[model samples]
Target: MAPKTTHPVLGARALNRATLDRQLLLRPASLGIPEAVEHLLGLQAQNTKPPYYALAARLEGFRPERLSALMESRAVARIVTMRSTVHTHTARDAVALRGLAQPGAIDRELALFVSRGGLDGVDLDRLAELARALVEERPRTPKELREELLPHWPAADPQSLSVAARCLLPLVQVTPRGLWERGGQVALTTTDRWFADSDGPAAGGPADLDETVLRYLGAFGPASVKDMQAWCGLTRLGPAFERLRPRLLAFQDERGTELFDLPDAPRPDEDTPAPPRLLPEFDNLLLSHADRTRVVPADLRGRTWSGNQAHRVFLLDGLLAGIWHLDEGKERTTLTLEPFARVTRADRAALTTEAERTLRLMTPAGVPHDIVFATR
Candidate 1:
């Protein structure tokens, strides 16, 4: 579809370049682990390794151990913030963003579980108090938390009690769970206890919704209200956009949907070179926006997932081009690429160089690595 003529429009490629620049994908950024986590809002961390791989993809001279150290020191943590999924966030954002999200996304998710009739006759306030006390004393795994809470409310669903605690409190996944190379099972604690020594926003204090909107533009802008909504899993944000309209720049997309961005935010040339990127499954670059055509091609929609699982994907020239799988052997590590379409020789070379760089940093040294492009 052609861009609408009524207003200055950003076509798909234009949007792609601008968003990639904001995402630190066009080039590796020179930023520390916590700073990068805050700037990108958070790293999708449904799995332990994605956050490390995500940092490797975006940061120059990134060592997995650096992030691991941060996790050990309470500098960053994994929590269920945006989209009600786990994200590795800076210490401060872990408090602020989770507080921001609690009223809407967290509560709504708990409601879904409540409506299932499992939480019948349960006093939500009592559940929150008991669960908070238990975790604050020490971090507890979801299973342990559920088992303890089940005895108190024998009639209530075991899982629902644990879910209620997560919703009612600003729970965070404690250390060793998110530490790279030293992984552990999921464990929960309130942000208040976890970041008690830290200085910044406190638990139960959410950042202003208006300020968050502006920050979202800075990171993933020229975006529609729906796009922002999709990223954070909050609704009725049109008012926040309206209040900031005077301070923002508005443009129409090809569909004539109004998009908002910071006036000074980078809107790179449409033809700017975008190197191939190997992103972890559920990377925010692919999941943040409602209209994903800017990053995902039309024909490749829904190709990233199978049933309920998401595959690790790679980009060629800034678009979703293929799936990648990694196999670790005692003697050698192999990375196989399965492209959605035939790749040109130049793109193939670039992909290999990128894969080797990732392997050197991620895999053990002296382990020979191979990058193979699978025949479709």
Candidate 2:
């Protein structure tokens, strides 16, 4: 059978509008926090503040308190999922997707540590069990958890032992840690204990990978097999896409990579206007695709990535236009915007308006903020 192809091509701008619509960046969505999180597949939350900032940009009338409350209530959690990095997921996805990513994520992690002799003379199964018990007894920071496990595996590298448990077990970073505007250490508890009413990976194993692929496409698609792999850190998803190909709508980029998307998913017109959006650092929109030209321009791609660090970036006319940073002062907060290309006076005003809105979402009421446009 001939491989399916989408006729007439989706040009770069067309792909950009479609992607922005699906990501909720074209307009603020009406969905609540948990629903929005689920729809976006979860937000990259390596830091405490990005998820809050991300929600602010995507959801209408979003309040930091709403996300903070969800954290306090255990409705959402911070867990190491896709790409083996921390993400803020609704309690349900934290369990389901973490399980799907584990076989590969855990093996890679263990292999690296074992090569360093980090797990030498240590029985990993026993370490996992002990770590689970300690965390379940009460939420404990990685350092605290390490001290408790050291007695059991005295010769094992403390950092590696803790990391192995993280890889081997299903742990969730408990609250007060990810709560908005609150300071707390990175703490862990088993997903089983954190979401007592919910089922863990045992209830949804490899079978869940099928749903994972569909959900990824729903949120980030018209994407290639490599894009799916990049987003989830799972390899060999071509078969999963093949299995679902009969039901999916296929398209090809100008570069001719095969793309799959849900038939009913939104594909906005090429001219759909995308507002300037101030995205938090490591936002999934900037990281999810193999061919990021859909969102970030080809010539400007290297600007956002420095070594391993991805900077906070903003979109102007639906493509990455600049990078931004925030500095808080005792009396006022300043948001600095640095554009990679020339910005018109009109664009600067619009960018300032968006930056001010972001400041309001991030800081307390009556805390004044100033927007500074940096020299290119």
Per-candidate TM equals 0.97, 0.95
Predicted candidate 1 versus true structure: per-residue lDDT over 274-321, tens digit per residue: 999999999999999999999999899999999999999999999999
The sequence of per-residue lDDT tens digits that candidate 2 reaches over residues 1-376 is 9976555578899889888988999998999888999999999999888999899999988899988888777788899988888999888788788888886656687789999998899888888888989999999898998899888888889999889889988889987898876758988999888888532222344327778888988898778899989898888989999999898988888987878889998998888888899998899998899889888888997898779887889999999999998998889888999999889999999999899888877788898888898865
- Work out candidate 2's RMSD over C-alphas: 2.3
Candidate 2: clashing pairs of residues = none
- Residue pairs with backbone atoms closer than 3 Å in model 1 (clashes): none
Ten contiguous residues with the weakest lDDT in model 1: 196-205
Cα shift from native, residue 312, model 2 (Å): 1.3
In candidate 2, stretches whose alpha carbon ends up further than 4 angstroms from where it belongs are 1-8, 197-207, 306-308
**lDDT winner:** 1
